[model samples]
Target: MAQAEGTYDEAQIRAEYADLTRELIARGLQVSTMESATSGQIASLITDTEGASAVLRGAYVTYCNEAKVKCGVPAEVIRAHTVYSTQTAEAMARACRRSYAANIGIGVTGTMGNVDSANPAASTPGEVYFAICTGAGSDARGEKNHSFHVHLAPQPSRLMYKLAVAKEVRDRLVVLLAEAAA
Candidate 1:
């Protein structure tokens, strides 16, 4: 679907979210999230859908590296990866699962705006990393997980960028859930 000048496709997002919620409910799986760049938007979108409580365990808005570390993301991992790499994303997801004991854990982190003095040049704006993890039953030691990195060049407005990232995260989760169901 085409996006307008500076807005996201809310209708499409809602429809997709509905499908996601349905699948999670059907599978009797619970999900939790630890978000950074997109803050808690991903988790918010998930819970906005009907029947969310059945599948959504909880969510954390770890906007700062300190908060990420507090929530289980290893400080060493963040130090090495700048809190924007796939490693940090994976660690955040694993931590979410361990913290909530949920079947699925999601982690989102990255730069969402123009580079500033405080922001490292290596972390490009509109570049985001998403990690989704599933507990492998008896062994919940962070074995089964998936991570994706996306670059939205010519980035849109801040709100639009955030909306787009949230949609991508939701769509990916749907695919993962479908594959697990099959």
Candidate 2:
């Protein structure tokens, strides 16, 4: 049980997230999140670092269609694009961004492991969508809008898939956050 001495402890401090958090703080940029399939994992990771409050104020877990709508994701976007589509994710990002008026907004929605019964026709297992909207033009990351979708390979378990997706977002955010100073 104690094989690796200093390699994999219970600290669970993801270097990338911590670095991203530091960068955001250094640049005086703030971030907010709206999440679905990945839940609050992205937000959770971002705040893992010290002084994260300087950059991250709050986040939302819109696990259901109603929750997403209640949190500000427009009803029309969900109806037209379905909660699992990139449009919905973009809506989530923009909504959270406006909600907190933060420089960055992170929105993620998807079917992690199961077909969504609420919208089964559009749900594809392991398929997810996420968007990052920034006020880069106004002294933040350059691109005002960025979006991504991924189909996780059939594998280990639900936890693994979620971790994979969270890491995916973290990696992409690293790229985006790096542009803050540029």
> What is the Cα root-mean-square deviation between model 1 and the actual structure?
3.4
Error of 1 at 128 (Å): 0.5
Residues 1-182 of candidate 2 have per-residue lDDT tens digits of: 01111122123437767888888898898999999987798888888889998988679999889999999989999999888888999998888887888888999998867888988999988788999998732333453768988877654676666667777777778787666557
Lowest lDDT sum, 10 consecutive residues, model 1, at 1-10
What TM-score, computed on C-alpha atoms, does each candidate reach?
Answer: 0.88, 0.85
Indicate the TM-score of model 1: 0.88
Candidate 1 local lDDT, 1-182, one digit each (tens)? 12223346877776777778787788788889999888787777778778899988889999888999999989999888777889999999888987888888999987877763454755777678889988943247755879989876554577667778888788788788767668
Any runs in candidate 1 off by more than 4 Å, and if so which?
1-8, 136-142
lDDT of 1 at 133: 88
lDDT of each: 0.80, 0.80
**Residue 4 in model 1: lDDT:** 21
Q: Report, for all candidates in order, the number of backbone clashes.
A: 0, 1
